[model samples]
Target chain A: MDVLTDEALDLAPCGYFEFTDDGNLVRCNTTLLEQLGFASEELTGRNVETLFTLANRIFYQTHFFPLLKLHGRAEEIFVTLRAKDGSDLPVLINAVRRPAESGFVNVCVAIPVRQRRKYEDEILQAKKVAQKALEENNELITAKEQLEAHRYILDHKLALFKQRNQDLIQLNRVITHDLQEPLRKIMLFVDKLRLDEGIRLSASGEQVIERITKASRLLKDLISGLREFVTFDVTENPPSSVDLNQVVAKARDLVIRETGFGAVDLKMSELPVIEGFGEQLQLLFYHLLSNSVKFRRTDLPTVRVEIRSSIVQDNQFRILKDRYHYVDFVRLVYTDEGQGFDTRYTPGLFQIRKKLDARTEGLGFGLAYCKKIVENHNGSISTESEPGKGTRFIILLPFRQSDQAFI
Target chain B: MNVEMDIIRRSNVKVWGSGSRTLLFAHGFGCDQNMWRFVTPAFENHFRIVTFDYVGCGKSDLTAYHPDRYANLNGYVQDVLEICRTLDLKNVIFVGHSVSSMIGLLASIKEPDRFERLILIGPSPCYINEPPDYVGGFERKDIEELLETMERNYIGWANFLAPVVMNRPDSPHLAEELTESFCSTDPYIAGRFARATFLSDNRRDLPFSRKPTLVMQCSEDLIAPLTVGDYLHRNLPNSRLVVLRATGHCPHLSAPDETIQVMTEYLGTPSLN
Candidate 1:
């Protein structure tokens, strides 16, 4: 039952090829030649990559060769060969490397797997779609996890803020009631000593009494200022559309009546109506006007204060763009011709205890009150000043505040 | 695991031989460090030989494969440099094959004083042709089809090898044993590696590397043609191009004698330093 070896190889059912170690084709079976529709001369002397499709050429170099070199054999390798007419012939190839007289030779046998390739292509297409869906699902899960983490952080911060707010209210009550009672008694006793023992007291004793009265009065004013500062945050006043012209007029009259300085030259431009607490805005303006009058130099005969306002886009402010979502903001510039402090003190100027000058009458709560008021309205305030020069305050307030703006 | 041990396990690093000078061999995209078996023996007596499988290939710890980190050749470069740093290898001779040639070049550029010289085999700076200036012997469509072929073959091997792998759960080395007959990899990871290898463009990085380089190009390489070799020679500032008589992409595997002969001749020349 032994057949001729050459006849058996040439007449095999599957395609066969043998190439040198360099991949130059030496011989191929008749079945392979007929499968590719090529003459022996077309493929015999050419590189084996020429018989493969462009993709299969890359596969041959990157995978097929390396496998053969490493393991001496490669099995069940899927590739596509190109026929002479430029059609792909999908094949399953098994190859082995052997030592030859010259160097090495690679022998491969390929079976046309057109039917199995068609089924595999369908499965691959389905798998790609499934993989894409899985990737999208994974991305969604990641995004949801990030959102949950952010929510947890925000909730924790809100709880801390509420606790602090409760503590502030408790402190405000103690300052208003317990501290003020003893201070009132001190003022009454000091008055009684000045009236009842006036003739018996020596001149130096009268001078000491005058100091006591002045110190007691200053203490009273400080307690009042501290009360205003702490109590303003406790009140939950809804925001309303308040006209700035009326607010500034009322604040100016209060400052003039309190300080008894009638030589103020106030100039104001048309102001915009904004959403804010009316009383707080009035207090904000009062602090600004009083600060100018109290800090006025004796050399200057008249205090000149100018108020200018304009609408600006959010982009005009580099720092506040990310803080607020408003489309437009009302920018107010308040300049006063008074004795300005050194510009170096501008950073801590708005702090409650940062008194720049010792000669000022009241506690240094004027600028602090102004900052708190502006911030409560979801606005920002900055000041520029130089010694002996005038001071300018720039306040930016949104035209309409969102509900979340109220802390 | 500690940092040094983690890297060693993750990359499946192997070190052998005994000498003062070191030789680090980085394999290309398709296979692992085992591909260098035929060539490493020749240099064992004179050089401290080093080899490693990139993450996601061979017996490397597959759990360390992160798609975001391994999305490009830079990730593979990090694998090589980490191995060198862990071993405290200095003044190394880097021998890279295929895509790894560019990866080694980039690593040398990043750490300029680490490598003494670079020996690149069957290297291509870019695989796609930019017509009117360069011919890299591949088209964009050709790469796409290559990916398709890889997917098909990967699915075929996964189906065939699943039963063998599952049945030998007690044998930790059984998977490696089964995959020894071919360059087996995770299908998903292999797709990404193929994309990174074929779509990379390192043509601009050639002039920056000042290390002495030896470019060993095969005569009839389908991946890296003669034109690509000439281009590399012209672009690399301090390099010598030697066209090997051997053919195919892996000349060391196809003709180890010729590959080692040229390397020995080049290393013997004292002027390269």
Candidate 2:
């Protein structure tokens, strides 16, 4: 029989050991003893757990021993051993369990793996770093996708708004040109008929002609108001600095001349010049003053009007912070002592043809035109009123309009 | 498939044996239900034996694995209770190994009427030492190092063993043999399981369960030391502690005769079941 000699076993290149089923070391080669810096007597009867570091001891029980018991062998199991001097020595182990006369004999061979372990650890660390970067990249991609979805929705909504605006412009052209031409011929022929046939006409015929002239004039006023509201496109006019004092003064003269309400007292304060459409700002104040004179109380001989202006921080209005990037806004307050309507109708007051009182004169497009003009200048207008009290209009306009504000 | 069949297929549940009373064997973290082969045969004659693999282990459906759900021990506890409910199992005798011991205890606490008794082998409520009061036989750093070691070994196996298995296509049996030797597990799922098992602390849950429990501990278990066993015995109500003469963590695999004898003796004694 050819058998390995004792001398050859002792001088083997790798370490070897044999233990019983209960893990008490029965024998170990000299090479293993030299590797662990232990004498034969020190390791002979000790349990095999003493040979491993604390972490590898867990690995041995949980993985190595279970695998050996189930499959009768374990290969290429990585473990770290604790030498006598308390330094760690990494090794790759292969073990097998075989039955002997007394019990099972477990044999193991370990190869010292210093350089291989170092390289493997470095590779593992690099892999971990790469995995982390990949996760972050995935999160960034998700955020970008969400932003793109929002932009797509906004673009779709803007296109719908543009289409609706085009439809309204077509309807306004038909009302101002086609409808007004026939109505103008009726007024001219009615005037001619009244002048040429005055002697032959009865009292009832003259009364009917008078009513026809009044109704046609009211219809004409409504069509022109509708046209002015619809055609005030802010994009056609570039913004420039305009003084609020000058706009208010010009608006007051036009309102008094148009209404013939000479008993009017107007008060004002120093106002700031802000960047906005100049013609739209003047038209906005004209509609506001005209609304107050039209709703004046007949019992009071004179109408009182006051205008105040100041600069306020943008955050003062909670609704403006999300939409505007401006720091400061110019606040203009217009108050008048006139008979006011029910405040419940304030929400729909800015809508065209929304009238508070059917008995009152003129169309209900005054407040609506005021709202459109204010908004075209990248500003806002809201009103507060109570029956039998007075009316107040508050306006907020940005000192410098943002380029993206129109859309 | 129906929901009942789905549950059975999801966990790869296997039912056998001739007796009426059921014995459900739950495997530990690293391996699957096949670990109970040596131990299950002994009880097959007198008791009905039930075994299953947790999702992502053995032949269980891998698609059922959700990372957020299985991030902690509660997910595994849910799996156990769901299996019990789906099978309509009542008064079950649950036998668990390693981390599964705590899992069984938690399930019994959640539904006390479904469980009759528990036999915990090599159970450690906590793996890392709390210091000053408790010694669980390991520190946090040691557990981390164990994870690193596991990664090294898994990567090493993929690089070293894949080529050898592929080159031997002439013998298909050789490939099957190699696969059987190394329990097939996805490396990523195995890493997650290791984290959930070793980082868990179930010491607070010990006092809540009052079932008849048998704590079978090995004499020199490196995973769950003698102190941990004594700790369990003191805290677990209506419990008994028996230290086996066997060594290492898994006595059921190494010394099945002794394991079966102790379990049979404990069952034979008249108490609750």
Taking every candidate in turn, the Cα RMSD to the unseen true structure, in Å, is: 17.1, 21.7
Worst 10 residues of 2 chain A by lDDT: A317-326
Return the clash pairs for model 2, or none: none
DockQ of each: 0.21, 0.17
Among all candidates shown, the one with the greatest DockQ: 1
- lDDT for A193 in candidate 1 is 85
lDDT of 1 at A358: 87
**Candidate 1's TM-score:** 0.60
Look at candidate 1 and tell me the lDDT of residue B254.
Answer: 80
Cα lDDT over the full model 1: 0.83
Off by over 4 Å in 1: A1-5, A99-101, A146-407, B158-181, B271-273
**TM-scores vs. true structure, each candidate:** 0.60, 0.58
* lDDT string, candidate 2, A1-407, tens digits: 11224888867998888777687887778788889898877875699888999888877777777666656667888889899999988999888777776867788999999999889888888988987798689758966986797689779889999999889878987988998999999999889878885456789988999999989998888888778767767756568889988988898899999999877788887888988887778888888888888889888888888987655434223342122222457777788889987889889989988888788776777777788777766578888888878898888887887666654
Q: At residue B80, what lDDT does model 2 achieve?
A: 91
**In candidate 2, which residue ranges exceed 4 Å CA deviation?**
A1-5, A135-407, B159-181, B271-273
